[model samples]
Target: MTSFFATRLAVFSTLLLGGLSTAWLQAGENPDPLGEKTGGSTTVYASGKNAFSFPLASLEDEERTRFVIGNSFFKRNWVEAPASTTARDGLGPHFIARACASCHSLDGRGAPPDWSRTLGPEPDATVALLLRLSVPGKPAAHEGVVPEPNYGDQLNNAAIAGVKPEGRVEITSQSIHGRFADGTPYTLQQPHYRIVDLGYGPMAPDVMISPRIAPQLAGVGLLEAITEADIEGNARAQAAAAGPVKGQVNHVWDAFAKAERVGRFGWKANVASLAHQTAGAFNGDMGITSSLFPQEGCTAVQIDCLAAPSGCPAKGKTDKAGKAPEIDDDTFGQVVFYQAALAPVARRQAKDPQVLRGQALFAQAQCIACHRPSYVTGEGPFPSLTSSKLSRQRIWPYTDLLLHDMGPALADGRPDFQANGQQWKTPPLWGVGLIESVNGHQRLLHDGRANGVLEAILWHGGEAKPAQQKVLKMSLAERQALIKFVESL
Candidate 1:
């Protein structure tokens, strides 16, 4: 390693040297013993059922109070304009849910609909998931997928009063069964999506769809706190690797930066900052405009949608003129703060022998090639949304925040900025074990197709194919050990 990387390791080693020891564990050996304490001293100890919405334990009293206030806006549904509720009025010309909490229930992942059981909430009604739409564009477009002209980038399954909804989302599935080295059979469900009930007209001849589930909201602020240098360095390191796991960076539009920047959030890393992601959700998911996204979400073809109430202020400010944006800047900022301040669940069972053995085996299997286990966030511009202690802190989020090709099985066939159909930003594993408790379901992967941790692992391909192969051959005991280590985190 060069001096620059050597210094990085030196700083990382210094920060993580003493909480525990992996000296006796080869594959698990790292000088950073506090790897499982993902947020370092800032980790929170909420149970899985209570996970995802807790504030950082170190926050000042004032910041803690702000978190509570933000929680109300996040959960409460917004209403249509011309109503008594002026502060939160102006619902969709077209939208996916009533509130942020609709998709991110309890600040946790959205559970995949159980086809065998009842159909969950209306797909567009903030049910914790939605489908992204785009048509292939020329290389010169450079902005990733082209939005379907009349419908825009996302398929909205619901609309506000007096406006025609964009379309409906329908899903069907088929199962694929495979066996482990020890002959234990496992089955994986493959989802197929169809867009029906087109309110406007037909989609482009070749519209591409990418379905995404709402992710758990813990530690997102810290994820945004991660520096560009570290993410780029990981990309460079992986490109130079002798293995199959070379990953690429996604350059996405950052509304705040007013330019394309390194993406670090979303399934395809299509978003650069938490603020951008939050504002985009306010507009696209809930049809509630914020200063960041000032216009209604209506497409040109939907005349009625364009006529929906917007809270834009009159030419000059006045009490009669409602908040220009349905959600005022102060409220939006507070929501961002709440999201940022939410603490990552403190790791569980890191000291177990099985988990440690699994940790070692995980390394041996080369899973770390893409699912990078640790990072040191750089000093950043994030203010109230960031904690001072989080600056330069060594964190173990278990992701590289770069896109890796996962082969064909998991490909969405959708281009997102610099990310191709087969590439995906390695999803973080820090809170992987708590999803079941938080959402009451254990669906994994971008579409909630993989049933659990192990199934998710089995579906890996492309750069992760070799890693998956290694996992496929491991003894059932060894595999369980590896999975146990992941669950412990």
Candidate 2:
């Protein structure tokens, strides 16, 4: 027992040196109570690059093999329907990226059009960025938000060959500048956009638009494993705390359950479970029908889109009925398994004095009120949710998985389920530090408008306005510390 404890302590000590935070130096003794395993025993030690794309360390041999299989489908591109390749066909009559990997771009966060800041023509060329549209009423009866009459819920900027792309996304922008308490200045770019070249005619005049960039997928399964009860408990604690931020549950459709459940995924917490979220992405982002979403994303006005060659229809109809839904349960299950199995990446430099100060400053600014530091996920029912190592382990994901008003600066002015226009979900912070290495950019926030972590923090408002103000008043050194601390997580 003595030898075992010493060995454990030594392993934990090693983790503090490389797994806790950015700039964490090797401590004289073990410092992390939970040790270096941020995602329990499933934590993967990777940084500088290729950090967001590894399987959990504790995943067993069969599970790791399964992860690789799922990854293939996640990265595979789907072609148009009525093609030689039936398994991968049924790409959008109207959709965005050809494959899941395109938007996610290596299982990581996406940015607004890369060409938006370039000197090239048609600067509004969108890649991973997606625009969600809605009106004043609920079209699905149960769904609170209504789809734009012509373009449906999402504006598919691209279509399969021989189909008129719904319309291209265009953005007009302006910049606002501000000075830190110490007189350091920064500029925030605000964007205004319009839909040009409407293939399905004009959208509803009362259309409400929301732009979302695909977020990183690592540790998502761990987040899902956090029980609903614990999530609400966090909300209760925040509501009773000495803070203005009050995060509420966003109950959204659970296609798998065929019922409404507390949403914990998406920018608005509009997706209930990984299954529902993945199925929705298959249909909404790629126009591929699954058992959960049998319909194409096309609206009635998109006559060409509806009439386009499709192996899978909203209803089960086609010469090959087996392929009508495009993605079968087995295939989608593998994809979800891969996403759920992607290991949480290690932290860097947690023991550094500067990062420690920044960590304290983050809590002092009340950012921790909404972005809760840690969670010990519940046990059992692990498939598509958690692994044994990821279960019941204290992990530092830095999210409450609840909806909070983010203020007008970040508002999409669109309601998703119970998420008000000004509300957004607390995004997880794991793998954030390595975004630059994996995706080659550091853009943050729902629309990828913030140039870096500082800008993202500065843009916080509404329930987070107080924290934003606190950060605004912080000295330059404190601000740097806070950002470093967050990046380390």
Candidate 3:
């Protein structure tokens, strides 16, 4: 190690050896010793590449079979319709990827295309990073957005053999530079996107596009298990406190419940349930239909897409209704179960003094306001599947599960349900540190613009501008400690 690294290691050792007083450590409000179990009993101990792939630790032996089956479907590739493999056929007339794992490799986060390499005429095809497109209009109460007259809600960059893709998504970026209070310079990549090679025609002049990177899937069920009352209470408390971090519940239409419910998933909290989220992904990402989303994601203008054969069962294999979704309820349920039951990997070195000090710095900076620490989950969305494992167990996910204005710097200028252009749902911080280990990349934010945690923090604005300012003013050691503390989560 270099002298600088050796010096850091020595100081870290000293801190671990009680260089900080016991009283001070206790005063900093260290989390529960078992807080390392990020998903409570559902937490997994894996820290390697396969960390995000494990099922809940508390799942019964029989449930493991379901998890295995779900993993298969999640990783399985779908072919175009009229193929021999009818079970997994009917991929897309126009779609982004053939399988869910294409973007969320290993069930972990997806990285954006390399901006430098993407500037060429033949840019890389974006599998994980998709563009959500819409036109300006008064959205119906149940509808969050008016789909662009041409390409529906999202821009698909790939298609089946006989059909042309909607278009290719191109990206380029400029470097943003800034410095800390100590004059330590930093650079951030600010991305610019374009939709080219339109398979159909030009989109509306006022079309809006939002770039979304597929987030990790671990502990999603646990997040769903957090009660509406608890989540709303967070919003109420923030309002009462009169803090700039006031969060609001996003009530969105639920396909499962057939009613408006509190949004719990998505970057904008537009999705209300995991079933809806899962089914929507099946339709939008791979063009595979489920009972929840029976219609294919095709526009009337796209004649090829409209005429494409579905992967539904043969005529003789029809149900009592004389029709069936491409993916039956059983298969869809298995995938949802797999997503809900994937355990958050256990934290590393939570008790280290440097980490604890950093934890204090994180709180002092008021990051805990939005990144709320703990919640005892309730019975999740699927009572039968989640069972008692996720019920009444305290988990430290570090998110408020509410929408806050993230400022223009991070805005996509697209409204999603109740979330305005600047508003974004607070993402959970559990397993954040392990993104590099699990996915071999540290891309963060909805569009994968930030390279790591610090960059993600620096990009913070709107309600979080104060918190960002606090971090900018931190001393080098203090910043390191704060980062170490967040990574330990």
lDDT by residue for model 2 over 1-489, one digit each (tens)? 445434443543333222333323343332354234678777888875568789988777888889999999999888887888777889888777778888887788888864343211111222478889999875575575888888888888777767777777777678889998889898998877777778877778889989888999988888888888978887887788776888998887788888877899999998878888899899998888887887788787777787887663333333355435788778888998888888888778766667666666776677777777666677733554444666766677888899999888888889988888999999988778889888888989998888888999889988998898889899887888788878888
Local distance difference test, per candidate? 0.78, 0.77, 0.82
Tens-digit lDDT string for candidate 3 (1-489): 244433444444322321223443466644344268787778888888888899899999889988899899989887888888877887887778788888788999988888853322222333378889998898866789999998999988878776778887778999999999999999999999988888889999999999999999888888989899888988987898856888988989988888999998999999989989988998998898777887788898999888888885633436576666788788788888888888888899876778767866776788878988777677766775655788866688889899999899999899988889999999999989888888888999999999989999999999999999999999999999889988888
Error of 3 at 265 (Å): 0.6
| Residue 317 local lDDT, model 2 | 39
Return whichever of 1 and 2 wins on TM-score. 1
For model 1, what is the alpha-carbon lDDT of residue 212? Answer: 89
Q: TM-score for each prediction?
A: 0.90, 0.89, 0.91
Residue pairs clashing, model 2: 21-348, 21-350, 22-348, 22-349, 23-349, 24-349, 24-350, 24-351, 295-314
Q: Give residue 62's error in model 1 in angstroms.
A: 0.8
Better by lDDT, candidate 2 or 1: 1
lDDT score, candidate 3: 0.82
Per-residue lDDT over 407-483 for candidate 1, one digit per residue giving the tens place of the 0 to 100 score:
99999999988899999889998888888888788888898888888999999988898889889899988988888
Clash tally, candidates in order: 5, 9, 0
TM-score of 3: 0.91
Which residue pairs show backbone clashes in model 3? none
Q: TM-score ranking from best to worst?
A: 3, 1, 2
